[model samples]
Target: MGSYGTSMAARCCVTDTRPTSNPWVVLATLLAIYIVNYADRYLITGLIGPIKAQFAIGDAMVGMLMGPAFVLLYVILGVPFARLADRTSRVQVIAAGCVLWSGATIATGMASGPISLTLARVAVGVGEAAFVAPAYSLLSDYFRPERRGLAFAILGLAAYVGQIAGQAGGPAIAAQHDWRMAFYSMGAIGLLLGFAALLLIREPRRSGSGEGTVEALPLGQLARCLVRSPAYLFMMFAFGFGVLSGVAFGYWGPELFTRAYGMDPVAVKSAFAMNFGLSGLVGMLLFGALSDRLARRSMIWPCRLSALALGAATCAILMASWAGSFGTARLAAIPAGLLGGGWSVGFMATLQYMLPPRIRAASTALFLAVTTLLGFFVGPWATGALSEMMGHDAAALRLALTLIIPFGFLSALLGWAAAGRVERDRAALHDALSIRPAAPLLARPAAEKG
Candidate 1:
């Protein structure tokens, strides 16, 4: 093995002082918290029909509520919170965020109009911003790089499970009572989980190069470092574009099903949730494990895998959107879910490997802020605006979704490009951190082997 490979292997094999709680237990707690976090965020998507009816809003307005209202505060606060996590206890940062977002979710149930709902959503964003970066950083300390792929995969399951809860469970609750009840129930559950996270999870010691403790870079230095890395830049945009279509579909897919097939909202969402959830579960685990094993041979494998999977996924989603019937749509969803679900696992694992420990959380936060703006903010809002311009019909919605297909293809290309740059960039990071670099593990392309 080369120096980079040897260092990574050593990190993986070294035993350290164990945390008070088991690492698996810690992972479970983080997973639960993450599930609740996403469930609260996506509940609005599931309740769009009821909320729109109650507020008498247009599709453009609904888009604003779904995209800007939540994402504005989320992307804005993410870096600051991640910096705090880098300096303080990540567990506390995450727990506090869970509590804040849960409370805001409850407030969403009480909104009387669009303005109030937007405000409540903004608060939810504020809390959610604290979770992802810190949680990923903390997990790195608990599980070594070799194991992180599986650990993150288990955590990644929260996204699909949460989607099921919010996209499916929300409508079910609203059906039983009203849309407001959905928020109430999800919020209450989140609040309890927040408290549980604080009580149950213990903070692990941060890992670093054995030569010395590495401190996080200041905001300016961090920005410069990210800008300097061609691989990071490519991957960041690739991730952004990769997720754009999926986010649009998640926000609008249920409504499309209802309008296109005249299916009941509850039934449509339930079916969507089940198809997506099961397929995603399998895909996440499979790709995560595959990435880890393949990466032993080459770091570029993760990016290569992501690019291929995303390209295939784009085709699947296009088919699902234009399917003739709900059954056919469900069939299409199986491939879409399987292919689309694991993109983040490889992206994130590769990113974590490239960055130093001190800045991992903050760097992740910065990366997310950009991607969230590109994916979360732009996807839903642009789709809604296009739908409204096109008369807000089923065909218009389908066309809008179709337009997003090109972005997925673009993402795949960029991911492939990123693969060529990752090993070089990772080596540069090691040099910049003053860590010793080992011999080459595998020969790289002449241009990228630096």
Candidate 2:
């Protein structure tokens, strides 16, 4: 884990007059690489129809592909990689993850059936597991705390941007060629992008004490420390419940849309992905920016309010999106995306604000393991199981998505509480530890990090 608060003096040095390095430039580069990261990772969803047709399996198999199979590998490897990120160059880890996932996605293009594709997805998830935590730590190194919400918002935008390309662009590409080509082409693009990321960004100087060695807490000590941090617990809980609601529904999106709207299966596959892809982008861009501005101005828990708003609004929209007429359903999509994207950026900020730079990556890996199992591995799979148990009803799936609303309400509570104490905790910890600014904190753009 790297230190998040690199000291106001060091932060000012970087933020002031460029001082030779630009955090914003670093931020932009990370965002671009993230776009490719996402495109390679999510392009598989656009190929669901062809994959299913080739395998002749049902939603159960799809659930495995999107959920447990991917998550299991992601969680299993994420912690160790987090440690690696702390030890090695985070930029290197990110670049390696990009290459690994891209290679895996390319392999998926050649998969003959369910097991092969599932294994390939496993590799993709494992690679992705390495990217995010270290990247966040690097980002904290890149910018000052005051600018963190915006920095995080920009990084969060990658989720939407990458997804848009994967969903909208992927379908068009798939339609023109084939699903296999879609995977192959995106993977190839990502491989090239990884090289660019590696070349464009050099590792920034370390922020505190200019120490290049990664944060190294013993496993027991790390676990004990995390247990004491309310912020960390709340962060994990927020994401845990959030994912249980949102990711679960997202996993089953095509089936729900097809059953409810009576669309062609192939079309639903693409449409479902694109639907989420587009609306999610808008919600993230709008709500994320708005939330950051409000947080900066008022600091009264903008993320919490945003979460509450999205939960309440999307509950109605989720129902409408499924039950209403086609046009109405399309109209409801905006709110649906509000729930998906709004909390993501805000929640991420909360998580970052909760931990110190020294332990953030490890903390990230810890929560990721828990949340990955609780949400990605089981949420979608259980929803599908419940949907199946309920006679595989579309209405049942709708009911499953409604779970997000209440879970989001809980996340709002957590976010609200976190907002109040996050800065206080950050300050208290820094003062108590007599934290110092690092030499590298003033040197480079984007920390040349993961």
Best by lDDT: 1
lDDT digits (tens) for residues 83-141 of candidate 1 = 99988889999999999999999999999988899999999999999999999998888
Model 1 scores what on Cα lDDT? 0.85
* Cα lDDT for residue 11, candidate 2: 54
Q: What is the C-alpha lDDT of each candidate?
A: 0.85, 0.68
The sequence of per-residue lDDT tens digits that candidate 2 reaches over residues 59-107 is 6677677778788879988988888877777888888888898888899
Which segments of candidate 2 are over 4 A away from where they belong? 1-21, 210-215, 266-276, 297-303, 313-317, 393-396, 402-406, 427-450
Least accurate stretch of 10 residues (summed lDDT) in model 2?
437-446
